[model samples]
Target: MDFDKIALEPIRLDEAFFHKLPKVDLHVHLDGSLRLETILDLAIKDKIPLGIETIDDLKAILKPGYRHKSLDDYLKGFDITLKVMQTDEALYRTAYELAQDAAMENIEYMEVRYSPILHTRKKLSLAAILESVLAGLRDANKDFGIESGVIVSGIRNISPAISMRLAELSVAFKNRGVVGFDLAGSEYNFPAKDHLKAFNLILSNNVNVTIHAGEAYGPESIHQALHYCGAHRVGHGTRLREDGDLLNYVNDHRIPLEICLSSNVQTGAVADLEEHPFRFYHDLGLRVTLNTDNRTITDTTMTREYLLAYENFDLLPLDILDLVMGGVKSAFIPYEFKRDSIRRTKDKVKKMLVEEAVKQGVTP
Candidate 1:
């Protein structure tokens, strides 16, 4: 019962250990995850005029570290990425490479979310954008054997009417690659409740919903996402700890908190990694899942995120396993698929633990 005493024991985890661990990422952004090399190549090929001719300059401009003055500052990097992602080919390649990148780190299942409306600047239709991204994911699955789904996101900074149209698109692609609807964007002034009509439409059509809340704001934003928008999952619910009663409500209801630690710090959601609420939420038995909200922008991988959690929180291998299982349970996939994936992940983790114990000459 004494968590402090348990936390004192060190658990050694290496890159190979995390690379072999089956994981799930429920909150990765498609446009935010294009490869750096891919971005440069696309920029030159498409003549997108990114202003940065070299990759070093690009990294300096885009790959800001795990701390920022504010969320808006962190979001500035998206402008360059989005500029190049305006075409069907760009969208398809980014989605496919995102899946490939996750699969390299042993992410067996992932749900990629992006605002399709953002990709239409090149005169591509909304349906064309969606299908292009889906096509890339489909091809990646065929090649890498990683199961993937799409979550159509409605940006709060955008119009509510546009959100409604995105909700309709999500419904149309429900059983296809698309699995859920999300409300994501700047979380301070743009409240999730403003987009309630889209959530209502999504819910009415029996679709899943997750909202970005409590990252830049506080518990009130999270409350709106849960109470008004009816989110099944909460993206970066970092401020939920401020409201004990609401935290208990989320815990009791088993709402999964998609905790993107690196992105949280980068967006100034939390002061730093040490101040992050992930350990607090996990210790209190909240359903917390790890994710890379933006791989390219944050310059992170699933393995790196798990490693960061291990190093920052001193989470044992078992704790990391629990988070992985929590992510699988919180995924938008069907119940049957969730069960099978959890089982497979558990078996893999068990085998890895035994191997690690044997290597250390310790009794399992």
Candidate 2:
């Protein structure tokens, strides 16, 4: 079992920075991040025999060793979560609670992804699943004031026809809440090029598209994601750092990489935090955004990710602030909205830093 915890030291910082900082999460999987207590409660209510008697048992199932050996192994965790998310009640609850968790973390905006097909086993139609997720988001919004949207994903290993249907569904619901279409799943055997028709359909319909690329494979996966699949953003594009040309191209285009540091480490996307390509990409001025791919599976949160990155990378407050701004800039929103949001966040972060520096009697 290669379940080594990534070594990390606590980052000593001012309290104000954590509280006042506004952030955005561009990539997160809804079902993959459920609270363990919620999962257990739901399992009991639904009479789903989870075999595990305690939270520790559940944690072991989600640990890296139990996680997929390849891209396939990583995605297998979603199956267990998705099984518990079949009913409209469960789906809505998970989506709403995910939003609540994001709000608690002070995430101002976030986009959640899931494969609608995976949640339809109980004869719940695709529209029904989507509607349930939207209902949860709306419910959470009324309570927490967090902005959220959905990105419907097509399982990459599935038939191309099914992929196209998913893309069409994403297009149909774009105005409703579906902000984009994504190709997710195993990356080695199932390349981005395998779903070109689906991505093309998405593009033709003017639906935003992103692809899970460069996580389990190499730079060619990223190339196909951008060039062949027409992906506007790359998910877990850790392998892009291996190629200087690809890195330059990504920076030149300002394409955002949705980085999941802990998830990457746990899933064997990289050897460890020190080996994480996020530092390389950030140093090269790539549009990089930090995220919790699956909070429970990775046993992490956005705040924890920031703290670890800060300590491991020796990142300054301004750099952390810049990363927040980077997430806003990379959001799959309309141009005007993205521009205005980034500008406002940048100004707010600057003011916050200045206030902190004043309190500490140091120039920041």
Give one digit per residue, the lDDT tens place, for model 1 in 30-121. 97898899999999999987788898988888864546799888888889899999988899899999999899888999999999998888
**lDDT on C-alpha atoms for all candidate structures:** 0.88, 0.82
TM-score for each model: 0.96, 0.92
lDDT of 2 by residue, 1-364 (tens): 0101111212245434564578888889987889888887888899887787677887777562343456567777776787789999999999999999999878999999999888877899988999999999999999999998899989878888889878878988988999998988877788778778888888998988888889999999999989997888999998997889888998999998999888887778887788998877888888889898887777777887777777788886557776898888878788878888877888777666555555555531
What 10-residue stretch in candidate 2 is worst by lDDT? 1-10
Q: After superposition, how far is residue 120 of candidate 2 from its true place, in Å?
A: 1.6
Worst 10 residues of 1 by lDDT: 1-10
**Residue 189 in model 2: lDDT:** 85
